[model samples]
Target chain A: MLSMQKVSFRYGKNTDYVLSGVDADFVPGKFYTVFGPSGSGKTTCLSLLGGLDTPTAGEVLLDGISLRQIGGEELRRKHVSYIFQNYMLFPYMSAVQNVVTAIEISGKGGREAKQEAEKVLLSLGIEEKDMYRKVRKLSGGQQQRVAIARSVATGSRYILADEPTGNLDKKNAQMIIDIFLRLVREQEKCLVVVTHSQQVRDASDIRYELTDGQLSLWGEAAEYAEF
Target chain B: MRNFSTIAKRAFRTISGKWKGYALLLLVVAAITLTLYIFFFWLDASARLATQARTSTEACILLQSNDRQQIGSLPQAMREHPAVKGSDTTTLLTASPVNFVNAVSRQDSPFDLPGESDQVLVSAHTDIAMSDAFRTGNASLVEGAFPTGSDPQVVIEDVLAKRNGLQIGDSISMSLSLPGYTEPHQLNLRVCGIYHLQQPIEATYYTSDGTPVYGASPYSSVFVPFDTLAVRFPDALSQDSVCFYLTDFTAISSVLEQFRQLNPDPARYTLSDFTDYRYEQLLQASQAVGRLILAAVWIFIGMELLILFFAILSILRSYYKDAGILIALGERRRCVAAQFLFQILVVGVVAVSVTLVGAFLLTPLLATLASGQIVHTAAETLPGNAVEIGAIENMARLLEEHGGNFAMLYASIAVLSVLVLLGLSSFFLFSHTPTRRLFDKE
Candidate 1:
């Protein structure tokens, strides 16, 4: 489980706080979504969750260890995988190579890592023939799948997706959402997706609304489902 | 991974992948390397010639004139000096047109001369035993042996011998005519020895044949016993023709000063610092041309490396985004930097290796080009015979004369060029911030 307790963060002096005194708990086998409009610090919250950035004045605990205690890079490397709105695949590498890079850098199996990466990509509907092509040549939907494949190959417990469907069409967005939910339920992984889509909101086991750096329960039914 | 070989290999791969970016730069570097190689060549050759120059240290002081009368009984003066140990004087006035043939039979003359002017060849004559010792004190021996014993013997110069095929055990006829005798006095003598003495005299003299040879060298004159010369042509010399051989060079000035007080002819007595008299045209000529070529090579190479740097910088900059993405994917910054570093090392190793190989392959051709089809008389100093302790002693003596060294020209150049190239490379390139340049591509 990951929890941020009364976490308050601001960009600079006298500037509006991006995450103002927010508290949240995330657990395995649960799907959570944060609903927010533009400038709602949605991506900012995802960065905090993945330990990409530090809280200005509060504690973000990974299984009772505060984010302050664990180095952000070590925390991200060992415990969380990030999926950006832009896919973030290495442009020059093929889909397989991109995923292989993550596994290699993470110090997992060597050549076996490539086999594992391909298996995951294949499961995510990456065409076997197309997997050898570079990411730049892949369509947006395919690239998004490739990014998801990398996160899965990392094998971390937590998947922190920022604006998971921010640039996708409704059909592709829905397909991505279905993939995240299935990963949480079938893989027994923790899922934290930041989205403004009502469909994503309704599909979450627990939901929170972040507005002006403050988080409030989305509705009592959503919290009840998590418990 | 801490695998330096892998890093090096990967770097080489990257370098190879982008050859066009630095090809011209590489070519320029190669040209410069060739220049450096030639510089080293000259440095080595010059060093060798300089060493050769060092060995031929000058022994005798130059008198103001070739006229021996002004020395004022130097032979008696030197024989009388307390500090003097051993001494000889050979006058190098004008070379005689002497021809030599090995004494095949007693009925035939050992010398052959048809068309030549009669001339006087005056030089230091130790007594037969002393003449043997004096001839031993020289660096080169072209043919024949040193003369010993007073059995009517003389050693012809080797150049004179070569014209008629003379070697050891040859005899030649030579005689000195006194001032009043118009008829040349001839002495049929055993060719006890022949000499190929080298020196720095300016007077040009030759044998019947036209091959160039050192003429009128102080040591190049014919050798005979001091007694024989006096007995044969007593009037040719006087109490005035005395020469001194001072053992301790430091006492030369005082000895000269004493000689001046006794004899009053300034033109008759002048000191010759033989070292100053001799010049190393080969080494000097090499340095002059070598410096120009080597400098051009260096400048050309430095410019090429700079061009390579820029090309490499631009290519790596274009890959900055890929680098950034890799960093974000948890690749260590060092690993990212290592890739680029590997590439540079690879190119450098290849470039230097290629140049070295090329230079070694072309060594003969270059050696020929560097030095035209020139004749080099390779020489060394060895004893005339096992009993000739004078030669062994002279070798050590001449070794000391040259300050105990053999190759000054190339040694100085090798050291200087290496120092300069290393200094230039370190000054221009090491510690340059490669990362900053890559990042600044933004």
Candidate 2:
């Protein structure tokens, strides 16, 4: 479980707040979608959940323990994995090699890591022939599948994806959403995905919206009330 | 091991994929290493040559007699001194044959002897300054070779030979005259060689009345083997002081000081250590040249390092994204640095190895460059007003004998410089910027 308590954040001293008095809870085996318009603090909340940045005030907790106490880099390595919207794959490496690198980084080693990478890519609907191609040569849908494969290959408890389907077409975006749902429903991985797509928001187990640096539920008049 | 291989493989792939940038780096490293090796080798060679020249050669100490009377117990006293007894000393009977050998002065002779009563001087071969002059081309045998052993042979001066019409194999008669003897002893010696002198000779002996009478040197003198003189005219010879030949020239000053304490009378005799003084001057000059070479080498090294530092900074700036990706993948900062260092070391080793081979092939050219300066320094220390090429050749030969010292020094310096440049350049780059910021750049 990942939880935030009265977290506040600003980029620098004297800059306007990107997030203030924000509180939320995330549990395993559920898919949560965070939706907001441009500059609405949605990505800021996702960055915090991924352990990429720390809140200026309050605490972010993981499994009832503070993420800061666990060390941000160690937290990302052991418990959280981040997938960027544009599929940040090493351009020079093939799909399998990219997945293998991620597995090795997560402390896995040897021929077993390579085999596991191959298995993960194959399960994500990447053909054996396409799996050996460089990520740059892959189609947009295939590239998204490889990125999804890389995040899941780590087997971390929580996956924080920032606009994972923002650069994809409707069909490729739906395929990525299917992968996220399968991870939560079958693999019992807690996932927090930030996006502006209504289809993605409706498909998630729960929905939250951000406005004026504050977080609220998608529906109900009291949801947008100040804390 | 697995983790390290992973990073190393990544670095290798990255370097190989973009070989152009790495090729430029390799070229710079090679140029630096080659120039440094040449300078370091020359410095080592010059220093070793200087030291060998300073200490190994023989130094001669000539002792001139104070009076015409027979040498007393002073010769024995000098032999007992620690400095004299510790060295190889050969005492010779040096005298003027003026009273015995009658000759007329030649028109072109430099000496101004009285008319109609001119005489020649004779000395037994002592194997000190005479041999040095012959070896350095200060005097050359114009006819036959130098007389050796106890042969009743003589080497006449060229001017006297020409004036007297004397030729090789001609017997010259000399009547030895002495005090209180009504009969004069006569001896005949065959002329073996005639020599020409290149420098003005300052005659050391005087006439019967204390007036200094200069001789015509090689032009109006005769030289025979010391053993022949001692055997044929034992009563005519005087052995006052001996010439002490020291094996190590650098010890001459100390030995001279020690000898003075033993003798206590500087005016009673004259000591000449010109050979030792000459070597000392040469040693000092060569050392100065060595210092200059080292200074030049270090300045080039500093310039090369600065170029390498900035070049590496620019390359690392390009590598920021790669470094950031590694950091984001949970690699430790040291691991990322190690990966970069491994890449640099690969290039360094290649450059150094190439330089080593290149230096080997260029040894002759490098030796010539080093020898030219060394020869100039060595020649300046010679007795002549100008540096002689013969002396330079002799110095070059000495340097060649000790060439291995230069190679060892060059190897050590090359390895040290490569390691230092790689370590410092990488460490400085990593310490200045945060890896996290690199990862977030689009």
TM-score of 2: 0.66
What 10-residue stretch in candidate 2 chain B is worst by lDDT?
A: B92-101
Which stretches of model 1 miss by more than 4 angstroms?
A10-17, A35-40, A67-69, A195-204, A215-227, B1-61, B64-109, B112-167, B170-173, B178-268, B271-312, B355-442
Deviation in angstroms for A130 in model 1? 2.5
Error of 2 at B31 (Å): 2.5
- For candidate 2, the docking band is incorrect
Candidate 1, residue B365: how far the Cα is off, in Å = 8.1
Tens digits of per-residue lDDT, candidate 2, B153-225, equal 8887787677667889888776544333346556678888888877744444446463455554432456666
Task: Mark the regions of model 2 whose C-alpha exceeds 4 Å error after superposition.
Answer: A10-18, A35-47, A125-144, A166-175, A196-203, A219-227, B56-60, B66-267, B276-303, B372-442
DockQ of 2: 0.17
Query: Could you tell me how far off, in angstroms, the CA of residue B111 lies in candidate 2 after the best superposition?
Result: 35
Error of 1 at B56 (Å): 11
Pairs of residues at least 3 apart in sequence or in different chains that clash in candidate 2: none
Q: TM-scores, in order shown?
A: 0.62, 0.66
User: Per-residue lDDT of B1-442 in model 1, one digit per residue for the tens?
Assistant: 5335434543453445446654654564455456556555655555554554443322334344444544434544544554343532332211111111111112233333444233324443443323322434443445555556667666666666665576666666655443445555666666677766554223333443533345443223455545455566555443322323334444567666766666566755454433221223333444555666668767765775576556545655544544455445555555656655555444544555577677666665555554431112111111221122232233233323332122223323443454345324432332232222211110
The numbered model that scores best in TM-score is 2
